[model samples]
Target: KATVDFQPNYDGSQEEPTVLPSAFPNFLVNGGTGIAVGLATNLAPHNLGEVIDGICAQIDNPEITLPELMQLIKGPDFPVSCEIRGIRGIEEYFRTGRGSMRLRGKVEIEENENGKSLIVIREVPYGVNRAVLQERIAELVNEKILTGISGMRDLSDEETRIEIELKRDARPQVVVAQLFKLTSLETSFSVNMLAIHQNRPKQFSLKEAIDAYIEHRRDVIIRRTRFLLGKAEERAELLEAFLLALGHLDDFIKIIRDSKNRDEARERLGSYKFSTATAEKLGILIRSQAAVQGDRYVFSERQVNAILELRLYQLTGMEQDKVKGEYDGILIDIKDLLDILAREVRVLTIIKDELRVIRDKYATPRKCPILAEAGEIAMEDLIANDAMIVTLSHRGYVKRTPASEYRLQGRGGKGLKGMETRATGKDAPDDFIEHLFSVQAHDYLLFFTNTGRVYVERVFELPEGSRTAMGRSIKNVLDLKPEEKIAAMLRLERSTDENGHDNTFREGAGYVFFATRSGKVKKTSLNDFRNYRKAGLTAINLEEGNDLIGVNLTSGEDEIVLVTRDGMSIKFTEGVYKKPQGELAEGEEPVEEDSGEEDSADEEGRPQIRPQGRATAGVTGIRLRKDDYVVGMAIASEETMLLVASENGLGKRTSFSSYRALRRGGLGVKTLNVTDKTGKVVNAVAVTEQDELMLMTSTGQSIRIRVSEIRETGRVAQGVKLLTLKEGEKLQDISLVIPDGEDSPGDDTSVDASEGESGSVTEETTE
Candidate 1:
């Protein structure tokens, strides 16, 4: 034992224990935050049971790896019933003793009495005061920094219940995500492990902290065993003295009666000696010590005092047996305590056993669940990856509804209203749905503007809406230039091959085809658009007074089709191959003409139009007559039928093989017979009978017509009226809904993946 002085007041007090004899390692269970001279510790608390399990595991296997240790102690377990998002911080903190983890309040979406969605906060992040958080939310709502929240109220009692009422048009999922982003509903806990060791402060890793506790536990167990053994042995000796006195009780009583005083009795008793043979004869167990010499047992001053002080009742016949039994029990206790002190493993086993008792009585279930990633609450985490029907209006409003909302309808049926029209305060005409898209929520949405810039985002980023809702302004979603309009969009998983070619879209399509209103066509390597800036990237360079009208993902070898407003259409090969390239990718074949031989070409075949740079003016694919303009372009497939729609709502499906292939830069033959009544050809795409056609008009009306209903006809056939457009409405665009598994680098199709799966992001890196 070491002596130390601690003065809490003017009066001094001295005490010492050398080191504390703790019952268990409480440092990890009840973690602390404190600071001293140049040292501090901000330890996160852990579950008692998990911590004990980990300690036992370490005791069982000192060589356990961090991953294995983590199996027992998953991470810090906060007392609050909130969510702990992501395990990355847990891993970092365990390995390095310094990291952070995200925490979020639990929220539920419910319908109120008025059928409007309401948000309820059930459990908040650790260390956050409910009152303060509610006050903060109230301030934000009052100031209008957080929109869509119409009202809020607190119904807190034993458990938290903060209800936030939403506007009729607010999306519950988006509002919940925004609350996490803007409030203490989401927070983080950081760990920095510092501790006192051997009277000095030290920074510690998780494993180091565990080991230190174990070593301290070892010291405590050993010291306690020594103290216990000493006391047990000391009492066993006193009992031995009592039993020996009982062997000569009458003589001892006579001596005590004859003694002149207590001191005399003690002196006489100390000087007396009993034969060792007497102890054996009486069946008494005696430990030979300083009080015993040679073969005789001479009473020590301590033993004499103990014998003299014994009460008459302890010397009675019935009590003698009790004294003997007590002595025997103490002897066993001494032996056990001695054994415990002798073996380190036994001490550890005892420690483990006691810890189990604590665990069984006090441990609770973990309150926090860990997520897998370390980013903010992403929509990808909440929304399903199912296909959605996204509609865009002429005035730049956009929204996505579940695709199941639209049922199968026959051709020539006037479709239900998909979006409500809203006029601008500046006297701009009321808007109508101009673009209809079928895309998986997780697909990459590339937005190309008439100004030649392109922006990319996930399909789920579009605001979710109910049927007939006009939706949020596109300006709030995308950073667009003045006078810019969304000309086209492609939902493709973008990636580049080792050769820096685009390969994710339609199997092996490695280029992007761009068409302008002036009959200009360009094909640039698709990889060139990878990893664009948030401000967007230049997709195509347009001539003065020209705008981009069509954009399609293309295979370098697919046939290119350009249709003009003046009824001119052309089919030309993207490239010419005299023979197979030195080597081709597996499951791929070289592009060849219709002769069915790799080296042969037919008279109808056309040469491949070489790709052009992004900034350069593309070569003319058609010679448009005065007042004529290119309206649509597509990567045509001979196996698929091409559907062409006109401004006057007339459309026809024709076998792509019916059209003769033409060379680039020419006055191509007419695919649709256009007259004043039929109007100009507006849009065309390669589609199949199983696919559905989404045709939108200039006045924002849309119709979904079954491709099978419109039977294939010969090229140059006069189109039948597909839909009766009201007064001024004319066809503006066409989107083909090919089922999943059909689009690839070679298939030349568009739209949607599997339904009911959450969206995934395709990350592309470029040098």
Candidate 2:
């Protein structure tokens, strides 16, 4: 009792315990943060089960290596729900006792009803104030350094949810990157594993920290067990005395009855003796050495006093039996306690068993996932690079369906419905697919917007959906201005594992060609867009009111053609060489300079669309008439024919060979005669016989037709009507997907700018 509290109160009247004997490792499980005279401790809290397991593993094998211990201990598991950036910092701290560990708050990207994105914070780094983090982010946004975020709301209650609303032009990835760089969403913990060991302050490695706990536990258990064993032995001795006295109850009663008063009775009972012959005859032996005389036993002073004070009911037969049972139980308990105190291993086992019990009852699994680096996901390597068909709706929804979902349709038939277009409500207009293309799951796509900024997306990163699903919104995925829409999209092949895997046509192998709605064109090397931050960079500088309409990836020597809704079309080359003075453009071969003017029939040709700077608006490819705009652009050989379709479903197939390759910015020849009955030409596509076509009407009706069904005709001929429409319905869009045979994207064929990549011209541009 005197040792229990060694410290005296200020009044010197009371004592308090200075050292607490906690059964668990408080230092490790609870951790600590404090400043000392010359050093400071910034220890991270760990999971109780992990700490206990580490202690037990250590107790089992005292020489366990750090790595073996780490498998069980992992690292500090902060109570807050944030991820540790890597394991290297954990290893450093565990080995040398000091290191810097990075932690990032958890965030989820969600789309709002307004077709905007929200970065919802699921957690904040340990010890960071969510409100302060939000404020810091808001300040950054106000200062214009973090330009993407528009607003913020703190919805944190029991769980943290700091909702940051992104502007229509804000990229979620870029906004998140800015948050990490500028705010407390990401933080570093400087781990200093310092604590008290052996009655002195000391720094400890992982093994040493656990070892200290085990040693303290070992001492505590040993001392506690020793104290319990002493108690049990003392009680058993008294019980033995009581049993011996009960054995000779008649003599003890006689002696007590002969005495007059209690004092005299106690004295006389103390003097009373049982002869050895009598004891042996009674089948009793004394256990207390002080009470045993040479062949006889006499009651001691304390025993005699106990006998005088003993209640009469204790002498009853049932009472005496219960006393015997209790005494026997005590004897067993004493033996066990003695055994435990005798062996050091027994105490260690007891500690381990107790730790395991606590662990079994209180442990929880880790909440935070550890990663190799910030923002890097390791699962991409496991995703198969299967081909997928991606579609974008006019209302900004995007989804990827497997290419196998689409089956080939026979010629001149009503097309199968690929999607059920139920919008948000009845008041909302039904949406139709504006863009459709096929790409490998691992490929990268460059999205050029009407506002001239470019962004990128991995094909696999898109949400996969059923063929009949509505798909996710593009506004929820990419950062775009509210008024800006996708102008042109191009597929760039990038190996997901390029450094480790051998791949042909390294990323950025070709050139990106761009055409504007205002009859302008430009070509830039594809490699220029290979690297960019998530917010993206400017792909082209647009003149006011001159929006980008189309873009394609070219081989730097492909033939380029532009078609207008007014039925005028022109074809040119992308390469630059000497022109024939009057011969502004020519055929597939290199152009030869001619001295004579008006020399029109040159077999040789030069590239027309020169590669321009990334920020430059290009030269004109066609001269548009009033109220006329480019509807489609194609790259094809003169052997193919242009199939022009109008709003009334009237179409014409004109041979490309008949149209002369003129100077890039010329008034193109009429490909079809526009009449009131024929309506205006909506689009034109280069077609081969085996290719298929899909047409949509304003009433949401659609049909499929084969290109071969339309007979080839002269450039100025009015064509046949392909479909009959309802009273108010008109043609809305036209696109196509071909079977895997001749229409398959091969090395030699010209690519359709709309279908994307190096595929045969199978798409009539609607987007």
Candidate 3:
């Protein structure tokens, strides 16, 4: 009790404490539950150390705000090890002292030797009776309200282990959800921190609770100091009397020996007078006038009695010095105690010091975990946030590995063997890596088809496989026509707008760049294809004999590079591509005029490029020769290095600066000198120094080579050999994989390679 004030008990026979002074914020630290006339309180228990820290913060700075206190004290920490979902309710409770807290029972799914699943309940919400919850669950199952329960038994011993068995065919998740709906698997508790203040019950926010505790501590410290100060003053006065009598030991002994009894000795000492000379010799400073009579110091009755009571040993020189020292110390103590009463900061400092000691002794790690959001978490939230290298084989098998699997190397060095491609079926042509790139599991992968259709699938939905294992077939995850093939794939991040709503397809983000094998190029607004349909969406309109060869997302500032099978490449600014004057009518065809294989000098060899609608054919991007078609299309910039691979396993890296910009539909200059030995250009892509290219052959042989390993040569030069292929094995496709943590390069493409007679190149082949 802080004070001695007491009141009569209910029967008026006994007295009771009016209040209990708590050193810690017990209302928050130990929590309580009570109800009175039209009033109730239910406070959740918090960490003791945290509560004290909050109290100390308030004492240190009275102006400390709520959030500052919250830093020391997180949301309520429960004793039982169960999850407390979200902080919103906790925040509201602390701010207004009343809110509902969401709580979930802890459970673990286990399996025995027979692979039968067992649900083990480890903990339950506060105030929930385990026996009652088990009975309720059994009752629900008996009434068929909860399904999938084959048997339920309380296996709880020392810990809260309630074993729940499910039917062989029953889903545990479904059963658990039903239990939560009917039983006490999940529950909520209302927090109301109502306490008595000034004889009136009042609700207290977190800050107010801590402030009240600090204020109480302040009062207790002040009261305690006043009491200590009185004791120190009395002790100091006694020690002064002992020292005075010791200094006049001879005179004291004579006075006491001359007395007939103890009473006479005490009376004689009380009236004993000391001369001014004797007072100076004794080093005693008499501040009271009553003690000084006629310029001579006389002892008071209290001091005289204390001196008379002194033992004989106290008269020794050593004892006398010790008494003097103790008197000096007691005087200092009295001054300090009085200072505490005169100033509030000293009292606060003492309180803080004591609290720190308590906190250090009692602090413990929290048992309950606080989730970022409340309610049942989606499965995706439990998955690891890791970037993966997703590789799709030519036969449509897909797998992903952690992006850290491959280490980058310089150009032309034998790269790491990432995966084996020899598992192709007999009917499959070659198991070469077709689509290889890095993306997070949560990203969206949009697959573009040769027939101009687009399909969307989450990266996580794709089966995970090891580096050497063939993954699950893409057909299993995505529905496709018998002969349909995915021509291009793009990864898009899940984005949110200002309101925190998902905006997967934000207008004005960029355009979807598309290119066809017939030297056709098209650019459609990305917003036009945001609505994802289970069936698919029409990405582009292709001519009768044309197939979409490449797709990428790009801003208008990118450079367009189109490489033809005849070793010709055309470079132009992406913004120069035609823009649609107005939206096209449904089923309307874009402008189409067949450009002859040979140059028609009078026909203005350049295309009058203009943007068109999604359901329209694209304008010519490159004029091709007979039997020669566009093999690759890439979005490039000044910092990009164009890696073009030939069918004969030959490739070279040429900087984008080496190519001159031209209007679309122009007959391009030679990019590679395609002779009898080098074969036709198979793949051309924009790659950074850190990128690695995985090349696959028709015989299922593949090799990874760093872009920097390949020689950088002139546009018209025949490149060096990239891979040593077996007889009858032609290069199929090239997939550029960017290393993790590396900056993204420009758009890339997979081009086909051809096999021809090995011979030295004499002159460049061009239309």
Candidate 4:
């Protein structure tokens, strides 16, 4: 809290007092509360020097208004970055006194070595954080508020980076100036007069308040001046009326000296209105008389002396001087009031001027006539320029062409029919008519007539070798007549592959036709064969057009096969076929023939074929065919079994116990190895109880075994015992048998005897 003493005048006097601890200056103590009371105002403290200067400037030249003061003085100089707002009522407040202050941040700038610059901010306004700033920036980016700034590149604890890629070259200072001028970085303060207050619950309009205050002050001055003037006029009128009523001095004297009361004294002068001289004498007498509470008139010594000394005429002059003094005071007061009113009016005028200047500086007009006119003039200026390409649109359709190129307006001026019609005569025949014209791929084509008639014959052929025309329309060329077509003049350029064969070019055919612009037939040729082939030339179609289809081969004879679309084939031999040969290619190999019934040693020195089968209980022995031989044997339970060898392997073994486990049709026991005369193992054998076996030599040759008969051995063998048969606790020697039979035998033996046990044997049985 601070105290300030204000003395209206520099010289301190008893009458001109000093105001101690003025509430006006101490308004900052409680942060300056303000109340707008109707026309009156209460503006809080501003900077002392600025305020004083502002007031003095206004007083010296009353044209200085509050807004002007604001422009000149601004606000308090705070150490921290701050913004003052809500001061819209400042003019009225200065006139009456009240306003508000809001604080905010200041924007700064920093530059880097890369010639890049960034806007820096040290502090933010009260109640605003870094997040708020970022959010605001993001919102602006989305809304396209901040132009030239692409977006916020990075935002962290210390700083934020905004991406400002300038569209054009701009100086750093110029860019910064633009940022401050157009964007919110520098200033985002708004003066809202609608701040709440205790006394003025609602907002105050400055104009309304100032006008009301001025009117009220004017009325006060007028009323005070009128009252003083009315009093002086009444005094002058009374004295003049009294002078007219008084007749003589002696009559007035009798009334003034002998009257017990003012009413009696007034009656005694009856019908004798005081003459100017008599009224003067009465005025002196009245002046000498002291005012009494009752009927009695008392006179002081000074009054008695004044009565004795008074001349009747002199009294009149004195009375006139008193009236004149009252008029003079009123006049002086009126002049002072007028001066104050003039000062206020001048202040208001200055405020208006300041507002006008501020508005002109900040609130610029939206539309610039110069900018708008530039665009209009540029558009009108478009004409023939070599570098400029023009797109002309008819209806919604547009075509691009060079600035001065000519294009075909359709026959009826409907659509693009041919090239450079403007260069050609419109009366030319359709054959000679070209609807499209170009200079370097800039096509000029007419689409419609002025009468809106569409010319169906209109065609637009894109220039050849145009990369941009890859998927564009080629409908114009394809509509040409058979012989008149450009295709008719096109020859098939044959190419050969690495294999010395010509590339296929069967597209052209007699039935295929190309047309010219006039629908006339152009030249006709075999080049159309390529076109026909691409149109899905089938075998039937190929045959129908046989004269158009030809084959050319460089090497091997190729029979021309015409395959129809439905997969049916027609073959035609065009040249002789030459055979290719080699001995190995014939699949021939040497093999040794077998001698009838010869006992030959296998690769392992043992007989290859084996015979084995089930025998009846009463049958003590069995026989085998010449093709069959003994291999091995086994016994189980009450059954005695024999072993036989065959081309494949050992034979079957059977017992009452074995038969119970496996019926007679099941596999029998057999040996896996065979013995020679020296009792050496020559081969390994495997057999089934179903009379089939496999014989494998030690040398790895294998053959199938089949059983024709089964036999039981009464004793063990003397030379080599092929296998020991076991029955319960007893061991028995089993003899192998070979059967002699007539069987068809000369066939490649890939079949295994074990396959027969599985019911897979294929053989003829004889009785």
- Give model 1's TM-score versus the native structure: 0.51
Question: Can you tell me which runs of candidate 3 are displaced by over 4 Å?
Answer: 1-15, 108-120, 149-155, 163-176, 272-300, 374-767
lDDT string for model 3 (453-518, tens) is: 888877765778876677866655566654677878888776777976657678887778888898
Candidate lDDT scores, in order, read 0.72, 0.71, 0.72, 0.29
Q: How many backbone clashes does candidate 4 have?
A: 90
Which candidate do you rate higher for TM-score, 1 or 3? 3
Tens digits of per-residue lDDT, candidate 2, 1-767, equal: 12132577689899766566667778877889899799899988888988899899889999998877877887778888797886778888999899878899987788889978899999999999977887788788778898888888998899998888988877687778778878889999888998766558787998887777777677677777767766765565455556667887887788778879888887777677777666445433334445668877766676666667778898898987887788778767766777887888888899899999999998998766665462343323435677676777778778987765554443333344566542233357787666766677777777888889898887877879977778887866676656778766777665445455523235556788888888888888877775554666788999888877677878888777788877777777776533333432222223223323232223456456667668887777777879998887777675667788888766667677666665667666667667666678777777777666666666444455567766666666666555555565576666644443433222222222233222112322211
Give stretches of model 2 more than 4 Å off: 1-13, 260-264, 267-301, 374-767
The candidate 1 region of ten consecutive residues with least summed lDDT is 758-767
* Winning candidate number (TM-score): 3
The runs of at least 3 residues in candidate 1 whose Cα sits more than 4 Å from the true structure, single-residue gaps closed, are 1-11, 14-20, 275-277, 284-288, 375-767
**Regions of candidate 4 where Cα sits further than 4 Å from its true position:** 1-31, 34-44, 47-69, 76-201, 205-209, 230-251, 254-261, 267-767
What value does the lDDT take at residue 169 in candidate 4? 35
Arranged by TM-score with the best first, the candidates are 3, 2, 1, 4
Give a tens-digit lDDT track for model 1, residues 178-291.
Answer: 889888999988888888787687778778888988887777777767777777777877877888899989888888899999998997788778887786666555554555
What digit string (tens of lDDT, one per residue) describes model 4 on residues 478-502?
A: 2221111111111122344587544
